[model samples]
Target chain A: MSLEVNGHKTYAYTGNHAFDACLPTVIFIHGAANDHSVWALQSRYFAYHGHNVLAVDLPGHGKSAGDALNDVATFADWVKALMDAVGIEQAAIVGHSMGSLIGLETAARYPAIVTRLALVGTAIPMPVTDALLETSAANDHAAYEMINVFAHSPRAQIGGNRLPGAWMMGNSMRLMERSANGVLHADFTACNSYRGGLDAAKKTKCPVLLILGQRDLMTPPRAAKEAAASFSNARTVMLDGTGHSLMSEQPDAVLDALIDFLRPKNVTAA
Target chain B: MPAPKTYQLDTLSLHAGQQPDSEFGARAQPIYFTTSYVFPDTDHAASLFNMERAGHVYSRISNPTNAALEERIAALEGGVGAIATASGQAALHLAIVTLMNAGSHIVASGSLYGGSHNLLAYTLPRFGIETTFVKPRDVDAFRAAIRPETRLLFGETLGNPGLDVLDIPRVSEVAHEAGLPLLVDSTFTTPYLMRPFDLGADLIFHSATKFLGGHGVAIGGLLVDGGKFDWDKSGNFPTLSEPYEGFHGMVFTEESTTAAFLLRARREGIRDFGACMSPINAFQIMQGMETLGPRMQRHMDNTRAVVAFLDKHDAVEQVVYPELPSHPDHELARKLLPNGCGAVFSFELKGGRSAGRKFIESLKVFSHLANVGDAKSLVIHPATTTHYRMDDAALRAAGITEGTVRLSIGIESAEDLLEDLSRALRASQKA
Candidate 1:
């Protein structure tokens, strides 16, 4: 299933039509340097189980064409507009890395529109080294290597060991390389400067899920731990042997956590 | 060490759980790094095992260093007793399991930490336990959700990332009406902003890894028994009133009325689960706790300044902070947290996800990590990060949108933090 969201033709893997109608929709937001295809597993798996899954290409990332952003709030506005466009009055947002930050801001800004939030491989106070930024700017090779080094597990890194994983990495690297440097820099800068959500985290009226990979060097589990601490209603999950790209590296674990969080229970059942 | 009748948090944070070293007279709490404690005699050891006495029998059950942390936190939370665990998750699990059985149920606020939501929504059901989730401030919803089998009512004092204030008293009333205890995860608000016990909570829990250990050095959790719940009155709590084969038929409520839950949690829950906190982590958390009051004050101040800056920014569509009059819960926040809310909030970008990403890229001072409550500022996009797992409907129910950026304000100079945010917002708009 597909529809126009924020002027972009968005695609979604509509889970069981009957289930999708009854169950809440889930929007998958990709991380920096990646496209909607990054959520192939999640979209399909979730859709199959009974969810309305929408995974769109952020403007200028994939099929969506628009000028990149320079301000974090602009992107947040775009998300709000997109939600409006799709007639999705409310949703449970699942974001990874850069997407996680966006999810945080979205829930914080439009508290009425978000039902629940799952921040995967996210952190506040993201630590980005100068070398990483310089390498990403210098060439595609450095950029790919840096992202891979920070995102993949040692086992996944072994040549020819995980062909699909490697292919995904290569494809994501290509997309990121194609993205404008100004946009990338802006994104990093916004991340570096962001300081609004902690208090929001403490007071979020909604349920929040903080997921981190134990081996994630980019945003280690420690960062998730810290964020989880401020959330009285929050819970933290540290996935063993997974890095920042938990969705790609261990989608099953991520899915398990999400399923656990979203399933209706005696308490949550309306 | 003899327990004082009562002490200030500042003093108790340093000395409540420690004694001058018997061998060295060390003024600081020495890490009894060893796993096992020597028994004075066989009868003493047997008595400990038989529940006739209270002492550390094993590391998994208790340790001197961890015990000190448990005591300190108990004192800080104004609880009769406490139990330390390996991690915050473990602490939550222990708390839930200690109170509930296979056929029991829980009434929880919908606004919760994701992990806790999962545990309540999915995992607990696997064990035949059930949960009912309601909006934090929906006192009526809580009352409506409670069942005859509901064993407890749960909520966080301050919700994570989005900063939704919990209406503790109203929910407490609902729980008490159902003859159930209210368990509050006070990790976010800490004791500095609000004390759950004073607000009517029967139990308080903390993920000591964050603000309590402000430096981000340790991972530990504590469960403090308010010593207020009447287990005997509520027949739902069998673990507290019933005899235990594990502890020679001793009933927790009768043996330790003021700390029945804590005693049972320590003796049976942590003991059986084997998720005791590490002595080293406990010691590190203690160090952080020593400065908690001061750190929290700075965090609150920095957060207020940041909120002011964001509220004034043109690109920001909405700023969700309880302190802001614009927030729907502003009045409730004032009544509950007069000292000011903790240091996390969210805002929407004009351009949505792309602009949100670009803004993150443009920042120079703030680090883009997934963690919060550090001495440093942090940022992330929720649409693309934390709430991704939730389907759109759930996201909407939870209030997540694509362009939203969640910020964890730090203890930095508010001016510098505002400048960095300004630059990032400008850069994102331009991009």
Candidate 2:
């Protein structure tokens, strides 16, 4: 779906369905140098099964026009602007990696607008390695190469992708490759500069879900404990043999966990 | 600077898409012979059919065995995804129909496999889709042939019979300039010789019946999506950028950033056209594909030997192999086909069609067959068979003579192949 935010054209995948405000809303945010299509399966399921899905491509990343935001706060504000533009008073926020940080910040500062939050492949203080930062800052293809190799587990590198025909490694790499020059650098800089993840987790008043991958090298599950502890009411689900690109590597598990969390019959919202 | 880490081609060949059978602990890939899959419940069935989930609904849409081979080929070709079809022609048809409709046009190489030529020149026009043929070497002709209705630019990695190297990088640039995607037939060269995607081609298809299934036991085709083209930005591909009513109003490009072409081809083309690869054929193809790297290397080695032998023979009028310095595209072939040109080549004899018949009848070891890329070396007189209907003028236009003989050198003993060819050539001259 196309919408205007801050007078700039913004592109969001509305699960191929016209957005209906009467239904419960779910906004899916992607990680660094990525776009709305990253949540192709996840967002579609939500849209079909009783929710209005908005998988947004952050400004300047995909079809969205305007300069890319430099930090988590600005991205959160843009998401707010997007929601406001689309008349979504409140919605669930589900994000991955850098997007997870944006979701955390949005829920922390704009709690009224966020109903629930789900973070996938997140770290408390998301730090960019010096090599990666320098490489991306130079707008070098090698930066994407490093991330592609590091993002997946050893098994994913060899390939047993559940989704037919799609090669996980190639698919993930191609998405990141679509980012324009210096856009990837801005995304990494944003992730590296963020300091409010733990604070955001603590400040969040709504129910939270942490979806970590066991073999995710980008944001290893072992490092998620500090942030996970900060949440007053958060559930953790670690997927085995999956990497940072868990949504693509294992679509069903990610969707099932997300669906079950969003419409819990047993566990009420905190 | 660290290099991008990826599995070697040989490694991917043996193990890219298949895992050990979780049910029976079988190491080999098990064929999912069933035509349809049982859904868990109503919701799961709805989700699968509605494109909300990814799994096999029917063998026509996808099959486990076919998908394994598809994934492996996509990996080897550096593509996002691929679709396996009943034959190479089916794969090409699926690709063309998914991107375009009636009244669309294509700019393609004039020197193509006879079957491909038939499809573009004769059959597609019947459906209101037209194609303008351009010389593979003439990049300018490719650009000039593009009309407003042109949706695609296509060529073979190695032009049939002549081994005319289709300058992919140059042709793809021209295609991109015109907002079209370059589709190349990688049947002859395969990924072992070159990856078209790496050279700017947006799409690639293969006759897996050829070198991919090196033993030539089964027939199948693979169409791979390079996943780099921006269909929305291109402003020409409404089939992808706009909502497709045929498949639940799915805008394919919005569904997957990298695999929009693949999604449409599988969902709409394969589902409706019903030209899908059989699991049994997929199994046979995979069994041969497992040793692709080594088999291709041997094929190249043996081909080099046969080309060398034919070049110096007394009965030969001329030999056409890209690696030979005498060939027109030798330098380009050296640059583009660093691994090798291909295993197949054509040579003219001193005598006419009668000589070709005598030569084939005299061969003791080599088989006289219509197919190429077999374990056994095969020969065919193109003038009498493949290009039979073409007049003498048209025959010469395609670089075929009355005595032109096409040879598909195989992984046999180089010495024995030479002896057989030596006898055939001598017999041809005597006739």
Candidate 3:
């Protein structure tokens, strides 16, 4: 479904269902150089199992139209505007990598609107290496190669995807390579420049869940210390043998963690 | 300053998708002949069935042995992923059906394998898909043939029978210009001679029964996706870019940006068509791939020697080997196929139909059969064997004649192959 958010066209996958504002809302945000498709299994499962799923392609990514935001704050604001446009009063926001940071900022800035927050493969003060930032700025293909190799674990280098015949490493490389010319550089810059994670974590009152990949080199589990501590009610779950590309590497584990956290028995249907 | 490069082609062929078998510590891949795997519990079963995890549940959908072959081939071809099928024709069918609907059209080179031609001309149209055949050498003809409904532009790496080298760079540019993908049949050249993705082809398929399976013990096909084509940008492939209702509204392009075509091909094509390859066949193909590097080199070496001898012989009317200056695609072959023009080529006998048969009967070492890419040298008279259904006029249009004899050079001693061909040529003249 396409919606007008902040005067730009934003594309969100509605879980193969027409968008209906009546159900409980869950929004999926993707990492840098990625779109809504990264949430393929997770979002579709939720949509089919009684949830209003909105896997949004951030502005200037995937099918959405606009210049990529230069900082996390603008991305957070766009999510809020998208909710207002779609007529959803409250939602559980889930994000990964750069998206996790967006979820952090959104929950902080608009605490009343964000009922629950789940961050996967996340870290506070997400730092970009000078080498990666510089190469990405130059738009070198090597940057893609480096990230593709590092994002995947040794097991992911071979062939095993939820769908048969899908190569995970190759698929990730191609997705990163497809990012609009200046998009990667902008995304990394935004992550590097943002200094609000500690502040956002303190302001966020909603129940938060942090899903960390034990082998994630991009945003190591150790790096999420500050954000985890600041949250009033935050729980961190660490998964072994998975990397930054946790969604594809250990999909079932990640989904199970999220599903368990998001759907609590105490919370009755609205 | 740069990071060290990963494995090369030789190393990738052996190690790309393989890990030491954990249970028995077997070094080589073991064929998992079982049909279904036991899930750990209810949730585990649900996750795998719901596409939340990556593991083999059913042999028909995926098997460990077949996945190893798929990944190894993808690594060799510089592609994102590959699907193993029952045969080359099945691979082609999966690729076409995944991207197109009933009203879709295709622009293909006229020079194609007889089976491929039959599929495009007669079979696919029966299902409502149409194809326009163009001469491989005519670049403008390809451009002019494109209609708004055209979904793909296709040709062979080395055009079958006539080794017309498809100018991949040029044709792929044309395809991208029209927001379409270029699909090539790389059966003849294999990845050793050419990596179609590197040359601009978006998707490639091979008749593994040939070069990839040098022993010719198994019949299988491999369809590889380069994962470079932008299906969403084209806006023409709804089967990929848009939500598909068949699989609970899964939008393939959203599933994996580069691998969407392959995702649908496996989930929908293999599921509905039921033309999956056997695990044993996949294991055999994997064995063939282990020796692909050395075997292809030997096959090319023998071909050059045989082509040189046939060019100088008195009984030969025309030699259609692309490396020779006399052939039309000689220069293109030099530019595109730097390794070699491939092991298979056709040569004409000065005398007519009876001479062709006499030549085949005269050969002792070369097996007269309907298949190629065998360990033993093989020969076939296309006018009588592959293209017998076509009338004389149709055969002429397809660049075949009664005197044309197709030879698939094997990895044998060059001297032996040359002597055998020499005897056949002399016998043909006398007949």
- The candidate that wins on lDDT is 2
Q: What is the C-alpha lDDT of each candidate?
A: 0.73, 0.90, 0.87
| Residue B256 in model 2: lDDT | 83
Q: In model 3, which residue pairs have backbone atoms overlapping below 3 Å?
A: none
Model 3 ranges off by over 4 Å: A19-23, A225-232, A266-270, B1-4, B39-50, B241-243, B387-395, B426-430
Instruction: Give the better candidate number (1 or 3) by TM-score.
Output: 3
lDDT of 1 by residue, A1-270 (tens): 345766666544332233244666777787776656566555655555456777766666544566655445667777888878767777788888877777788877888877888888888756566765555545434655567656765433321111110222333333465556555655655566667657657655678888888888888777767678876677888888777777656755776688788765511311
Q: Give the DockQ (2 decimals) of all models.
A: 0.01, 0.75, 0.40
RMSD of each candidate?
32.3, 1.4, 2.9
Q: Judged by DockQ, which candidate is best?
A: 2
DockQ winner between candidates 1 and 2 = 2
Highest TM-score model number: 2
Listed in order, each prediction's TM-score against the native is 0.60, 0.98, 0.92
Q: Which parts of model 2 have CA positions greater than 4 angstroms off?
A: A264-270, B388-391
Give the runs in model 1 whose Cα sits over 4 Å from its true position. A1-270, B1-6, B388-394
Q: Give the CA lDDT, 0 to 100, for residue A155 in model 2.
A: 82
